[model samples]
Target: MGSSLLPEEFEQAALGLKSGETRRFEISLPADHPDAQLAGKAIQYILTLKKVEQPRYPDIDADFAVSLGIDGGDLERMRAEIKENLERETQRCIRLLLQRQVMDCLLECAALDAPRTLVEQDQRRLAEIARQNMEKQGARNHNAPISAEMFKERAERRIKLGLICAELIQQHDLQAQPEQVRAAVETLSKSYQAPQEIVRWYYADTQRLAEVEAEVAERNIIDFVLSKAKVEQQPMSFEALAKASQSLFTICDKRPEAKEGPPER
Candidate 1:
C-alpha cells in the first residue's frame, strides 16, 4: 500500500486510520519483485492487523554502507573530506574572532553617533547587495526576508565605522594620489586576461576611477592601522591569513557612511 502511494498520501492515510476512518488496502507483488534488489529496496507490507506503526531506521553497518552508495573503503575518504571541512570551518571561526576583537576595540576607542539617513541608506544598500547575490546564485532567499528595523541596526553600526574610518583618514592625511591610483589600476589589470582593456575601462569613467582611488585609500588606512597597532605578528599559515582577511573584510564591507557632523569626541 505504501509503495503505490505518495509520501503525503501515506501520511494522510495514516491520519485517516488514526481518526477512526475505514481505509481498504489492496496488495499485490509485481513480476519483477523476484529479481529486484533487496539491499536498499522499499518494501510494502500489508496485513489485516489493527495497528499501523511508524518505521524506524536500523543501526548502520555493512548493510548501511550499501544504502549510502559507498563501501567500507570509501568511508575513509568521506572521513578525510569531513576532517578537511571541519578544519576549514575552525580556521574561519578563528579569523572571525580576531576580526571581531579588532573591530570592537576600534569602536570603543572611536565612539561616534551615526545619522539616521546614512543608516537607512546603508541598510538599503545591504539589502540590495543580498538580493543581487541571490540573483547571481540562481537562488531565492525565501527564508531570510529583509526588514527595515533590522536594516536600521546594521546601518547604524556601518555608519559609525565609516565615520570613524573617515576621521582616521583625515587625521592621518591618507589620500590616494593619481600615481597610486594608476599603480592600483595596473596591479588589478594583471589579474585579468586583457590587462589593457581593463585598464582602459577603469580610466574611461571618472566615477569609476574615483571608486578605485577610494578602494586604494581604504587599503592605505588598513595598512596605517596595522602599522600603529601593537600586532603580535603571529606566524599563521596562508590558509589562516586568507580566512582572517575574509572575516575582516566581511565587517569592513558593511561600514556606514559618514554623518554630517564633527568627528565624535
Candidate 2:
C-alpha cells in the first residue's frame, strides 16, 4: 500500500513474524482522512498469515489470447488492445482531476445557496442511484444503508455548481459545438452493441441532444475556469497516473496476495 493508503506509523512497519503467526495492533487515523466519517478514529487491525507462496502467472501466448477471445490469438494485437484501454482510462482520470480543479476554483469565486426544493430532489435522486448501484453489486440488503439526509451536503454542492454552470453558459452565450457533441456521442457509444445506431439515437432525439449540450457546456465552463486561473504544469509519469487510479478491492482475494507473502527463497 502507498503512504496515502496506510495509517500513520504503519507504513513499512516491522512485523517480525514467521509463517502462520498472527499479530494485532492499533491504527490511528488523521482527522482529515478521505473517509471523513473515520477521521480521528482508532481501529484495531489483525494480521493473520496463511500458507504463503509466490504467484505464478501464465505466459503471454496464443492459447491465452484465444481464451480471452481477442485478435484471433495474436499476442501483438492483444498487447495493443491492452495499451489502448489503459490510455483511455488514464485520459478519463485526467479529465476528472481537471474537473475537480476547475470546480474548486469556481466554488471559491462564487457564493451560492442552492434552492431547498432542488437540493431535496437531488438528495433523493442521489440516494436512489446509490441504492441501485448497491443492488447491482449483489448486495442483498432489503433497505439501503444510506439515507437522503446523508446525501444532503453533496446534493447541495452539486446543485450549487449546476446553477453556477448554467449561469456561466447563459451569460457567456456558450454553445455546444456540433463536432464536440458528435465526438462525445462517439465516445459514449463505443461500448454498445451497435455504435453507429447509438450515435444515430443520440442525434435523433432533441432531448438527448440537450443533455449532450449540457455536458459540453459544463466542459466549456471547466475550460474557461482553467484559462482564467493561474495554472501550473507538472509532468507525471504513466506509472504514477495508473497507480493513482488503481483500486484494490479485497473481495475474495488471496490471504497474502503480493503483500506479506512467502519469504523469497
Candidate 3:
C-alpha cells in the first residue's frame, strides 16, 4: 500500500502527522534502486489528511475483571491464579514428555510378539469407539461399515505396549500408592464446578480406582526406566514442552526376511 504518484520518502507517515494537517517530502531513487535500470531518478510528493482516529480500549476495571471470571476484581489475585494454572500446565507437559520418552525407549527394547487374539479384541473396541463418536455427531451412517484392517496395526501396537508395561510392573513390584491415586483423582476433578462430587464419583467405583491404579503403575514404570537409563538433564521452556507432540510407542521391524520386503498397505 504505497502511492506511486508520491515519492517513497513521504511514505504515508501518518502516525506522526496529526489530524487536519498536511506535509510533503521528496526522495531521490538511486541507480541501484529496484525500479531504476541505469540512472537515478528524482521525484516530488504531496501529503494530505482527511481525519485521525485513535483506538478505544476498555479500562481494566472491576467490570472488566468480573467479565474475565476474576473475583472481587483483584488484579494481583488474578495474576497469581494465572501463574499457578500455567505452572500446573507446565508440569503436566513435562510429565507427558518424560512418559513419551520412556514408552518409546521401552518399546524399542522390549521384544515380544503381539497376540493375534488380543489385537483382534482391541480392534473391535476401537471400531466401537469410532461408531459411538459418529453417533454423538448425529450422523445417519453411525454404524457404517469400515475396513477390518483399518485398526489392526494400531491395536497391535497398543496391545504390545500394554504387555511390556505389565511385564515391567510385575518385575519391579511396582505399586500405585493410594495417595498417588487420590492426587490423580483430584487433578481430574479440579476444573469441574463440583470437584468434591466428581472425586466421590471416582472413589465410589472400585473399577474406576483400578483404572487409575493401572495408569499410575505405568507411570511408575516410566520413573523406574528413567532412574537406571543414562540420564541427561536438558532444560526446556514451558511453551516448547506444551507444543511438543507427546508421541505414543512404536517399533520398526528389523527382522531378517527372504526375497523382498513388501510395502504395507
Work out candidate 3's RMSD over C-alphas.
Answer: 17.8
CA displacement after TM-score superposition, residue 44 of candidate 3 (Å): 52
lDDT of 2 by residue, 168-263 (tens): 888886768889888988886764546788788778878777776667766787777777778887788776665553432111110111222111
Worst-scoring 10-residue span by lDDT in model 2: 249-258
Q: In model 1, which range of ten residues has the least summed lDDT?
A: 31-40
For candidate 3, write residues 62-138 as lDDT tens digits.
77777767778987776776787888777777776777677768778888889999888877776676566568779
How far is each candidate from the true structure, as Cα RMSD in Å? 18.7, 9.5, 17.8
Q: Give the TM-score of candidate 3.
A: 0.65
Name the best candidate (by TM-score): 2
> TM-scores of all models?
0.52, 0.66, 0.65
lDDT of each: 0.60, 0.66, 0.66
Which lDDT value does model 2 have at 93?
65
Residue 223 in candidate 2, Cα distance off native in Å: 2.0
